[model samples]
Target: MGERYLKSVRLLAECLQGFERFVAEPVRRHGLTHPQFDIIATLGNTPGMTYKELGERTLITKGTLTGVIDRLEQKGLVERARNCDDKRSFLVRLTAEGDTLFRNVFPAVVAHGKQLFADYGDGDFEQLDHALRRLRTRLDTPGLVTPGGHVPADEG
Candidate 1:
């Protein structure tokens, strides 16, 4: 049973499906992709971050982030300016419109996110978070490499 559960790709796929469906309507209503919203939200917290830093924080690759930035720029949602401190890098900042939109939509987005886990009480959520954090730390440690924590593996 344990082996069957571990090998079941359906479980992971369904989890991803649930997450995608949960956010699909709201993201579409806001005229944003999930990644776009994630970038904007990260920028809202850390203003004037370079594209590299933004990519790191958003977990978006450079190539993908460039496209997102281009779209946001065309939409007048984000502005890319020369980084005064680092001439080699471009600083990404939210425009006034972007700021206003984020401010308006963030609360609703947060509420909707909360609704995703509404079935879990605070205690359960806390415990889940703690366990996940531990798992992350273990998997992410630089020096302690294990097969499971190494390069992506195909369980299929």
Candidate 2:
């Protein structure tokens, strides 16, 4: 079981790394890092979100989010405004330039990414999606498996 688990985890990580590498080219061509692109994509069509919301939406960690936003601000691609509802926190939104970039780059990157999975049929996609979701749910559930890989027996 442990060996199988290790193999599955390794495959998952390799797949993610491959996908990132494949998609990162277009993002880099547009002068953005993966996390920067993530932030721009998240804030693209909306009115903006609080830093907390932005942090939640993007894959970036809280420690890294501020720095990414700071870089985007310096690039004149995004702006931060005082949230009317919460004076203490700020709302982040894309600038006109950033929106334009998102409109152009997002679709292009997505199209490029689509090529990677062009061979996958509808059934393949459905199966992959279902399996991934099931794995995610199991991982998210608490106390299903302990750190040592033992399932706790219920105490009556």
- Per-model C-alpha lDDT, please? 0.82, 0.90
Per-residue accuracy of model 2 over 1-156 as CA lDDT, tens digit each: 667788978999999999989999989999999889999999989999988898877756778898999999999999999988879999899999999999999999999999989999999999999989999999778678656677766432
**Where in model 1 is the C-alpha error above 4 Å?**
1-13, 143-156
* Model 1 Cα shift for residue 138 (angstroms): 2.3
Instruction: Kindly report which residue stretches of model 2 are placed more than 4 angstroms away from their true locations once superposed.
Output: 144-156
Task: Please list all clashing residue pairs in model 1, or write none if there are none.
Answer: none
Estimate the TM-score of every prediction.
0.79, 0.87
Task: Tell me the deviation in Å of residue 62 in model 2.
Answer: 3.1
Q: Report the C-alpha lDDT of model 1 over 7-123, residue by residue, as the tens digit.
A: 545765787698878766776798998888887788885567998999898889999999999999899989999988879999999999988878877777778777778799989
Which candidate leads the pack in TM-score? 2
* Global fold similarity of model 1 (TM-score): 0.79
